[model samples]
Target: MKTDRRSVIIGSALAGVALFAGGTLSAIMDVADARADPSPEALAQAGPLGDVVLGSDQAPVTIVEYASLTCPHCAAFATETFPQLKEKYIDTGKVKFIFREMPFDDLALAAAMVARCVPKDKFIPMVEMLFEQQKQWANQNARQELFNIAKLSGMTQTQFDECLKNEEIAKGLIDTSQRATKEFGVDSTPTFFVNGKILKGNRPLADFEALIKEAAPT
Candidate 1:
């Protein structure tokens, strides 16, 4: 029987990624309304690795996004509407944005791991770069392609290798994903929780603007 290299690569890349430590995993599963809309506070709580947030914490509106790195819709939003959203809202201190990983596949998980390994300040830029060049690297050799991307942010080859093999980082991401799924009912990529209101999919800029306006207090 022939062995599938991709499977081996992904398996190796994601080894021990699914191990959720502590009682939080069980607590998340025990939530009475896994599908209920989460409170803004609950949604804003950072995962195991903590959150790399943008804008002021006291902003009038907070936008929490659960996205997969390899999801084209997520890529679209990252490369397209996010800039405008950042300039008009995030940068202006009207909206605080939080990006959470909810990877839907092994490749996305691998990409998320690499994104997490970058410097805190470089995280958003790395995410945007990965989304912009997603077509170029996502379907190619996982190690080489991801390493190429990782190097752009000053990560050495050794660092990249170590990142992929870091059980803690990988597990943190999986824990975050599970929490998003079970606690927040985030079933799709690019699901935005705008002030605790669930808004799914890659909507137009106008739609986001409208939602932000509605969420903003008078």
Candidate 2:
């Protein structure tokens, strides 16, 4: 599959690129350059989700993943590739994995919030569920589908409704994603930052294993 062309901004306000079926189009915006922070405070804030340390944090290899729950490719990666990666790298402590939200639509955003609503210990499982059931939810009516899935996670209708309507949480997620896009130049779902080097799209396990070996410390 042909991946979309991603535009990296070296200055202020990263522009959004539209992804079409066959190709992508982007318009570069000229603006005052924003100074890049060698270590962003956002990394610190990610701690609530889990341990996200700096400077070869956890291990020599670090994988920062950006994914959307509604994206088919994101679902594919989670289902087909994440388990092997987890067993080989994450579980062995050879790599530290960070999962970031990259919602492309309101449904995706809502699913992101749902994953966050669960306890930290359940976060990964909830996210996996979201991806595993993507087709079922994606094909159904948005509101009903979301509520039904939330039920699986033990969220009541009222609780799910409130969680979805929480503007503060929603804004926080959007801001985090915006920071990733503006700071790291991420433009698509399932973009992986393997120790700050960008790898975009869902690829086979062999491709990731090769990158992992290259990133891992000797």
Candidate 3:
């Protein structure tokens, strides 16, 4: 298949990043036990693309997550830990969850773009599908594979292609990532800011619970 402007968009976005061995999963598996001081003001700063948040706005605790689409650790958290977190915290209005894109490769950027193209209400479900079916699609034939996934959400082939070629969406994701790296020292996939306290890695749900409890108001 002939490449399209989507390729150019990916190339432009990943220009400086090392394309080492065709961008193997860059997610760090075992992140060190580390945390950063809370930056509530910085965490509250809105991105250009705007946030698709989950749970009540008045929730006591807030979680801001920056994850890559192609990261296995991120998939693990999304498919496994996130459900429990959503059930116990988000659904209960105890925590507000915010997901931000931090694409690690060209494929990841493409996936994030497609996810953003969907209606705002469908964003979480679209991301859930991407994570659950990651093994099937995150490959050399990423374009077709991602289109297949998008189709499941009623997205047409034209929409899929258009989403991939959308430079504004692409740039928004890249800018979000750059700001994350600059302001929060985010260097790995699945990095999170729980009430503005940075936590790295695909930690167990218990780890999240502990932080959320601490952040919860007395």
Candidate 4:
């Protein structure tokens, strides 16, 4: 198998740093070479083209989130921090929020597919359900976990199976996600772009509050 390009470059840079400290020429050369290389397909899978729009197209602040359903950090953010932000900013018309799927594993991809099955109006709620039950679906050994979650979301078994088997939808999702990663340089889950400023990781409510305050209308 071909080694992932990003990993190779990253490993080379780290080894150079450790093995040649004193600002050596060889280390500098390695760093330069790594810089010339592009990231791998995995890193390039951030989102789709035209998927992100700044500010409600009207709101002062736009929050675009690239997240994985099975990621514990993402679940924590959704369950703990998002509600406050939604109430204080999104609901108040001060901010517009867009969620893009970033699948970290097969389970996460499955969850993303199920979330997309719901109508656009129920998209956020279905997303919340997936995050809220991440543990149940993520930990279960059976593939039926996805089906079970789908049923809870009002999908019959046949519908769930058909949706899961819909290769076109899956490919479209993957393509969109890839476009997002390539365009936005998204390397990790739960990455947020608030008014185009990147915020990585599962941050506390205070951080969001500060950004919202900064972006709030005068």
Candidate 5:
């Protein structure tokens, strides 16, 4: 808790620190290691990637999801289908879930990056909030909406902007989605890879259950 609180203070300072002149460069350097394509030296100092995993890693089923923060169908799945799936399979140690970003627009990418800026453990909850409130945000006032959502995790407006402005993270998201498109033919939101079988769009709970049952390790 102490560490997280301190991080909020430091992270908020990052937005305005560039105006300080004396500490601006040093502040940038401090988070430089967090850049997506950092050198090995920087990688050594890098923070958590916020790629949260649920259930045991050794679970029989592995579900990898590629979704966008601003996608309505993705939110539908999160709000409706996912809970049932999580309750029946994921929470029972039968499935290991991994979420990957596939942001389709500037606003989606910004939301994704803001989700990444928080403490790693808070990543999934932040994602849930964004998805649950997808209709409320994803507007002309998206930046403000995103800030309101991000503040639940202790992010200030300046920190929220700073997180979105990090090109490395933004580029990394683009690169990831592009790779998914070229290699895996992923061009939409709520694409799921259930033990290698690709299921696209918002699938109902029954569809996911059947898919999981078929793909789940015996």
Candidate 6:
């Protein structure tokens, strides 16, 4: 929270990378270059399924997350803390969960595209697999490995290719990232909005549980 927003986000302890669909290609996008406020019209726009949301729409608390697939902290939360939160909160309709793509780079953007291409019902599961096996599909020889994971989500290679190359999908993801930066000052991965309160970085499950308990409608 001290450094320049762009520097803060781009300089997170990003410890890994991922491969894109069909392999043999990669790109690095600097988050700094993605700085801009959307126009009023653009502000009203949204991505596929308006980004993945779960739990009852009537849940008293809404938790919105901005995460980058290549981010280790993001992966840690997904692996260690998310399940407990999901079990105690989302699954019980105690909290409405929203997961938005805040891709840290082009490879991440590609992964995000694949997640979105999945069936809406399968989105969370697909993302869980991506984070769970991140090391497998986040390297130079990740084409086939990624395909295997995509297959688990019912995405064919043809669909995978089409998805990575889809301009609209790419733009939608970019817009989501840009809005996160512009509106929320999201400079790092695993940034959580707990009932509209910003919780940056990878906080423990207990900490989040407390926030949920405090925010839940009485």
Poorest 10 consecutive residues by lDDT, candidate 4: 25-34
Q: For model 6, how does the per-residue alpha-carbon lDDT over 1-218 read when each residue is reduced to its tens digit?
A: 12243543321111112233233333333344432322323333455438577889788877888888877888899999888899988898888888888876556777877887888889889999999988877776665776788999878889877776666666677767766666656777888877766677889988887777777746
Model 1 clash pairs?
Answer: none
- Each candidate's lDDT (Cα)? 0.76, 0.64, 0.76, 0.61, 0.66, 0.70
For model 2, the run of ten residues with the poorest summed lDDT: 11-20
How do the candidates rank by TM-score, highest first?
A: 1, 3, 6, 2, 5, 4
Which residues of candidate 1, in runs, are more than 4 Å off? 1-13, 16-34
Tens-place lDDT per residue, model 3, 1-218, is: 11122121233343213232244323222222233654877787878899879999999898999888888999999989999999999999999999998776667777888899988878888999999999988865666788788887889987876676676887788777767765666767788889988788889998998888888745
lDDT of 1 by residue, 15-50 (tens): 423311111111122222346668987887899999
What ranking emerges by lDDT with the best candidate at the front? 3, 1, 6, 5, 2, 4
On the 0 to 100 scale, the lDDT of residue 165 in model 5 is: 60
Residue by residue across 36-153, what tens digits does model 5's lDDT show? 2212222122123435578887777777787887788899999999999899889999988878887655456667788888888889899999988888877656656778888999
Assess the local accuracy of residue 72 in candidate 2 as a C-alpha lDDT between 0 and 100: 93
Higher-lDDT candidate among 1 and 2? 1
State how far residue 36 of model 1 sits from its true place (Å): 3.3
Candidate 4: lDDT over CA atoms? 0.61
For model 2, residues 42-132, the per-residue Cα lDDT tens digits are 4434622343222235576777787888889999999999898888777777877878876655556667776777667677777888899
lDDT of 4 by residue, 1-218 (tens): 01133211111212212222323211111111211112333332344322432234467777778787777989999999999888877777788777777664445666676677766666677788878887887785435766676676678877766665555555556655455455555656688776666778899978876776776747
What TM-score against the true fold does each predicted structure earn? 0.84, 0.76, 0.84, 0.73, 0.75, 0.79
Clashes of 2: 0
Compared with the true structure, model 4 gives a TM-score of 0.73
* lDDT at residue 43 of model 2 (Cα atoms): 42
Error of 4 at 116 (Å): 1.0
Question: Comparing 1 and 3 by TM-score, which wins?
Answer: 1
